[model samples]
Target chain A: MAKEKKVHDRVNWHKEFRLAPGYIILSLWVLFTFVLLGWVVGASFSTSKEIFSGAVFKFETGIHLENYAKAWNTSNVSVFFMNSLVYASISCVLLIVICAPAAYVLSRFTFLGNKLIQNGFVAAMGVPATMIVLPLFGLVAGWNILNVSLANRAVLIFLYVGINVPYTTIFLLTFFSNLSRSFEEAAAIDGCPPMKTFWKIMLPMAQPGIITVTIFNFINVWNEYFMSLIFANSDKVKSVAIGLYGMINSMRYTGDYAGMFAAVVIVFLPTFILYVFLSEKIIAGVTGGGVKG
Target chain B: MFDGAALLHLIGIGKGVTRLKKNKTMIVVFVTPAVVMFSIIFLYPIIRTVLMSFFKIEGVTDAMSKWEFSGLANYIKLFSTELFRISMWNIFRIWFFGGIIVMGLALLFAAILTSGIRFKNAFRAIIYMPNVVSAVALATMWLQYVFSPKFGLFKSIGKALHWEWLEKFQWLDPSHLFIALLVAYCFGMVGYHMLIFASGIERIGTEYYEAATLDGANRIQQFRYITLPLLKGVTKTNITMWSISSAGFFLWSQLFSMVVSNTQTITPVVYMYQNIFGAGNSMTERNAGIGAAVGVLLSICVVLIFIVCDKIFKDNDIEF
Candidate 1:
């Protein structure tokens, strides 16, 4: 019995030792992330000279709160911020409005060309944005629609909605199909129209899936850069991502590294705050799509 | 009585026909917007891109009528170019080597988090936060804050450790630039893949682990005999995802390079962009055909990998 106990102790020790590396790596990564972000936050509040001198952590020079003000007002981060907010929110809502109905019909109803549409979406997921971007740009330019700022914004939103339809529809398809048909049957028995049934009972049943996909769309649209860079090139309509890129490029001439960091923080804040609050939803949205696919 | 009943049945059949017509109309109403938008924006562009790859267009903005039919010339030009070859090699390294590092770390972290570790949620959240931030911001933070030779984190650490050479490491230099970008990109990506792996690991029933423990298996043994085997599907998913994302690597390479055509950090997408936009000196004559060809080649690469993964991971017997 004593020998068995000694062997058990040895096994426990071995297990702990085996897990030590995992713990170490995790802790190191956590520490590095915090330190890096903390440093950025700190530098954003410091003077450029102080930041360059590596005195960011030292509070000898009081925090320069004007970096954010300069970044927001003079550098036009506010415009970009509002632009991003508008684009992200509108695109997300429209994506759901357009995609949910399609997904619902595709999953719940047996219609002509249903399999073909399903296969189309699945095939679209494999095509990269680069493949479509050149032609799309040419088409828009050829149409001369981008000259109007509103039209440009509309095109961007439309592209966002269109590009995301496959993923959103595919993500919600499984959710709609998995729901029991009894509710719909009852609704039909109660003399409810098919449209009304979808709007009232079925949509409510798929609320969780809708919310998850919306969160995913929000994050994706919020961070979208390449398309925005191509389509929304004007100062009046730049998203936060492109605005930040512009700020970084201009910083070379201006040499306001602190202001640049401030702009970076301003751009990163919303997504960071979103992650803090709705991480579970975000994780569910991302991993849900991945695992299902 | 039989004639009256037959008339009533005929009326009932007519009503059913009207209802079916309404249902079909509703389906069209429901699906029309997505289908129309998808065809115009997604499908049309893909078809146009494939068609454009066969023509010699001076610029992306050029009129479609101006395209000169040049079959397979763009592909030959792409293959003949040294920089294009280098870009291809860079992406391959990123897809395979970067993939190995990322998947390994993600699996390890996933296993640890699911092992009843403390602060699992907090650790997961912190690691994944980088992904929430835009790649532009993250790359800037890395280029300026962490990799700067003067006031960088590396410099500070190097000074603290009394290592003079380490403090002056030129991470952004051409010699080391690719590796630097790879490391930074991997840092931001680990959490995303880790979360995917964690979800996969969490789906496994505790009974497997309990049974293995009952048989006196160690943690490593349980991982080897059960977790790894069950994670084949997840691994295949991660590889395919990594391939797709790597093929589309643009922003990081753009951010890392000082010039538009910097060979060290160029990827296929960046090459395509340069050609389409007529950005670089060597690429002054804009050729949408070459750009489209680059895109077609990259798509083929992704599709081929996906097919290979599908074949290799065809086993569905381990349903759990």
Candidate 2:
């Protein structure tokens, strides 16, 4: 009876020790992220008075909808939001379309100078985008584009595509190479042309890749600042990222915390919502990009 | 129900009706938009920048009119300038120490979590959460969270600990500014690199560890023997990218540099901006030559750094 009781107590102890030190670290990471996000959302809702007063959980009186309205008008958030959407959408579409064929050719073809082209792109990736930004500014000024007044949205799109090409090509090359070649071959054997085979067979096979590159490019373009500041000086072309800088810089002394937080929420909400719902797709994209090849 | 013979006949007919056209024109048509955009948007600007860097401009305003062909002068000036020296040193400091610290912490976090810990996915998603938020939003949040002398959490904690540094020094001031910025940069980037490392760790086979455990090896021994060696390729990739990114880390510094107006802690890009778009900072106005000269210098530094890193790592076949 004594031996059996000792064994039972040991089993209980082992059960209690299931969560290891690794689990503690993981828990802390999760807690930190949640707390940071909670702080952002809480600060958004809380009035300046409540924020300073230490009434952390009084959601009823602290909540304010007017702050968003004030920011929307005063910060020109609506205009910037629309501009960002336009720029991001156009840039993403252009990036994928431009990069997809380049990636395909690089991955599939064994033409002369293929190594040279690949090296060029890899070298470009190593070069800082900021390094080139100054020269481009001069070029833009010299060309007298947009009548030398403001940087054009179209030009920004052009710049965005350039910055994105290297990354996109590499990303898609991995996806294309990993995908099976039999379907395209079979399609060609069945009297479909090479182009038709690529579109009907190979393109469909690369859907996950297409989605991943598009999402990443979209986010990158959306969050871009330095390039936007250089190439998008006008009100109509200012993306939300650039606009946020303008607002914060202007209001730094005025202490418009609520308004600024409102702008932050507006900027953060769409992507956050998408990530929350389509997390599986995002995870699949990231892992597939990294691991499959 | 229809007869089996009729169904078979109809399936063959359906296949015949949807036969594809064998046209080579379609390939060109499909490929044209992409090629044009790539050539114009990407290829053109790069070529233009490289070519323009070689030329000399005489007048500030008339960039087109006052250009002379001057070879390598811009590059020569780049090497001579004190500003360039400081910027290069700053870039090295950030890349060497800051990159190592951030990437190291990320790798450690990734390794610990890869033991099939509970809430693994939740932890990963949370860590990556920062990447979703705009950098502007992040900087704003961090500015308040760490820098506000009165209510900033760092200040309060320092005070509670009776730290002289808190009382005597300003974190965002020139003396300690880079340290503060380095901390913020690490916080912002750790999640990204962590995800990369975690995904890499997941790719490592569990059987290696299982065999090690059976052979009288402890957890530490198993990791040291198996995990570190396997993680070499990923480590290289992370290091290369972070190094390149650090070398280019001027944009945000430029934006927030104005926080301390009239200070020259501004990166190369900001310095260029101040020169070109002074906006009444001085009646002695913009110069394209200075801007192009800076660009040429920056590019040289980037290429040199890449070559040096490749030499140091000496492993070109990094899979990740």
Candidate 3:
């Protein structure tokens, strides 16, 4: 009845009993998280009065779909949503474009300052944003370009891409190093140049890593608050996070709780949906991409 | 700048004719853009921030020539400012108190998840879900709903349990605000550290546990002797990461106490922001140098923590 090598399949009551406390602890924590997120989702569809009374589930007057509409139009969440979408999409593509080639070259070839550059990047990851933001803000304010909407949008995306470049490049560098050099060897024998070899052969083989990194980058840029708060000053340039923060503050005076909750839902939905689908890859990549590998 | 860089590239390419030259060209063309971006975004600003800390600049945009050289005055003024001192203490409290809660829960959950549990992926994903969402929204939910006085989760629970005193406590009140912030923040952070610990646990070979079990060693003993010792490296990582994130603590504190900076939640970054960037809450005359000095001091704290961690966790030669 027992396959000694396959310990996962066999279940012992004693072991299960011993693990009862752990199961209780994990399930309770997970349940609380669900209740927290679930109650918000419920409140978003309820009237402000119903939410305050804690009858969000009664559906006394049916679901109020107009909360999303009011939030989207009246609260100007649509603009912030679109701005975030554009910034995240553009930043993701630019990160891949800039990081892929550099990762490939750094991993494939050993040259001067390679180790120094790698060490510098690892160090930069630990550098507090405060350390760098002051001067960057100064330099850009000196340029006096933030007042213009188009320039401000471009600057925001550029900064997003710039801050993320080191992480993305180093992540892809590990992925590139894992790939065999035999493909490049075979390509070189066929009169293919190094750059051509990278684009045609190695790049396609690194699709999984690139997709993981792009998803990671997408979530990061979407959820980014501090940089966008500091850089994107105007409503036209504001991201969803800043937009939601503004709405919550104003809602206090306006007393539109339902609409404010809808805005919160809209702000967090994109990354939550992404996480729902790719939790496996995202969780696995969390440690590898987050700290020093 | 682009024209200058393009001209340099042109001049550099004009001299390459051999195989080595072609390979060099490829490497140069590929890595130059990233290095350039990093230099502008991180390198130049870091250098400037450090240098700016030593001089008294009237405005954020003051030219270098206008920066009056005032050695250590900024630091003196910053430490002397009562608000800055309070902000430093607040951040330290967050790091100390919040670190204990996050690390404890993180380790507990990590151990449970890696204990041959079923549906491990589902549990892990659910726990880590908060980090996937916008932190601003998460804080908003806490401030508006979870801690709302009219009808909050805690209040409702307290009422249902018939605990009058618990229900009467105002979580958002100044007396309880810091604890409330720490609780909400720690809840979101545990998932990240748990994932790190889980990965560290997974890396330990199962054979060791098997060997211990054959010798009649129990789970707790095995954990105390083997798991704890082996997880020293990952524990260091957890602490370092927690410190780094704590150093950049602005979003939550700002969200908690906006418009006017509250003493309970004001972190050094928030203080720096209000001082230099002028979030329009000026408690004192703006000294841009003090803001820069705060940045420098925070960075020094991070570096010091890193060095201390390295010393605490020696490079043991015990081969895995």
Candidate 4:
């Protein structure tokens, strides 16, 4: 806040004039983005006939909420949306549970192979999902779990959690390192076990980092497409991304462009909304941890 | 020995020993689950993919007993296939062409934002907005609306400006599809990289700029000499991320090309899918081995870029 106030001094017209080109470029680019997303939102509320006639802005009759209703109900967007919510929520909880202790250990302990484990996680961040998808698919298909619905969702969630484990651990490890070790020392002096000290005291202290990473994990799992496309073959277990792809392809046949845009809006809304609220934190996370890879 | 042991116990070594043992136990318990998950999810699959790339396996889920040892035959065959070659070329073009555009625009935006621009946060947020949205949906917006020949944003703007060429151009035509895909992709990507560059710039203290200004250095000169050089770490980061994402460029390409794989949009991962999981395999034998080889090739590309970047951007512990 202090720094911002310092930067808000009276503007020089000459300086502003000198930056005219830069301002124009950025404004035009941002204007184009608005037009692009604005047009989609407009089309989603307008009828397909009006959309075809470039009257989405005019809205000849009125705003039609049926497009969203049809997309949410008739198109199985509900199933996909619920499945994604479940998958993302469960996967995020599992990531924190599975990664927090591991990251704590990695940060606090001078154990054998600690550096190797950290390096492995970092490198795995760079390992493309394509490189590892085939054998995982083979193993899952061999187990024949994707054929069953409950087991299918379990498989999807497990994959989501597992693929994110490395990142979650690395990100949390950085958080743990920044914390002062004096908390554990005092706890130990007061008869608290090291593990208990971590759970009781240190974990809550690391909430900011945890929340940031969880937001990232949530967005990642929500937008995850390729693996879901490959593994969740049935509509019963499909994520929003894969489900939306199927709907869009079918909408090509149906020619309900408004409904298609509505589905697109529905599919992207959760993450988009999360982003709207937490853009600062999300941006911080991008530059914070596990991003070096 | 008995006397020494008794003396050590009296000195509290026994209690300390137990504490150390307890700590070890805690360490094992805490670290094992993550290691297990990582090994199952990443290690085993990576090893199997590498080994599978060497064998002639008809099915992706084929048993080990059915795998035929084929040396480098799969690699050779992958290079020989025309579609595979085109896919490789397409990805190369994406990485190369898209890299130039994204990095350039990202740097430009980063510079602009840090240059005391108004509404900086809003511009950054809006630019990065598309990235958080699902790629499938983002690509659909471009394909269905932005590239729509009739009432697309580009056509509307063109018509409003009375520009016949822009109004009539088939932006989604085969000849222009690749460029369209690249443009849409770079738009989403620039925001992330720009934030990275902006953060790097912010980390450099204002002291340096002040010092440079006092020494009669102008904004452009100071930026060229100081800002770019100080951003080596962030540039390495940006490049590594861009390459990694490009290597796994499947979702957007898949959305753009759909089921019918085209030369303009097919990437190695898409080709890998076509070889393994694609439907209607009437003529070509289902060689999951080739798919494995493509996976291995992309992994290699990622690692190579990483090593090259590390060498180029050797860290010297610069302090603000």
lDDT of 1 by residue, B20-113 (tens): 5669978899999889988987899999999999999987888778999999999999999888999999999888889989998899899998
**lDDT tens digits, residues A16-135, model 2?**
466466667667657756656667677777676665554534775847888898888877999899888888899888787777876765666554555666666666667666446654
Please list the residue runs of candidate 2 whose C-alpha ends up more than 4 Å from where it truly belongs after superposition.
Answer: A1-19, A53-60, A113-115, A142-151, A283-293, B1-36, B58-65, B69-72, B75-80, B155-170, B262-265, B278-287, B314-318
Runs in model 3 lying further than 4 Å from the true structure: A1-11, B1-21, B259-261, B316-320
Per-residue lDDT, model 4, residue A244, is 96
Interface RMSD of 4: 5.5
Clash pairs, model 2 backbone: none
Q: After superposition, how far is residue B129 of candidate 2 from its true place, in Å?
A: 1.9
Local distance difference test values of all predictions, in order:
0.86, 0.69, 0.87, 0.88
Q: Please name the candidate that would achieve the greatest DockQ relative to the true structure.
A: 4
Shift in Å, residue B129, candidate 1: 1.6
CAPRI-style quality class for the chain A–B interface of candidate 1: acceptable
Per-residue lDDT over B100-217 for candidate 4, one digit per residue giving the tens place of the 0 to 100 score? 9999999998998898877888988888888888888999999899888988888998899999999998878887889888988888899888888888888888999999999999
Interface RMSD of each: 5.5, 6.0, 6.5, 5.5
Off by over 4 Å in 1: A1-19, B1-22, B62-64, B163-165, B259-261, B317-320
Task: Calculate each model's fnat, 2 decimals.
Answer: 0.60, 0.34, 0.67, 0.74
lDDT of 3 by residue, A16-104 (tens): 88889989999999988887888888889989999988898898989999999999999999999999999999999999999999988
lDDT of 2 at B5: 51
lDDT order, best first, reads 4, 3, 1, 2
Across residues A34-112, which tens digit of lDDT does each residue of candidate 4 receive?
Answer: 8888889999999999999989999879999999999999999999999999999999999999999999989877768
- Model 1 clash pairs? none
Q: Report the C-alpha displacement of residue A270, candidate 4, in angstroms.
A: 0.8
Is 2 or 4 the stronger prediction by lDDT? 4
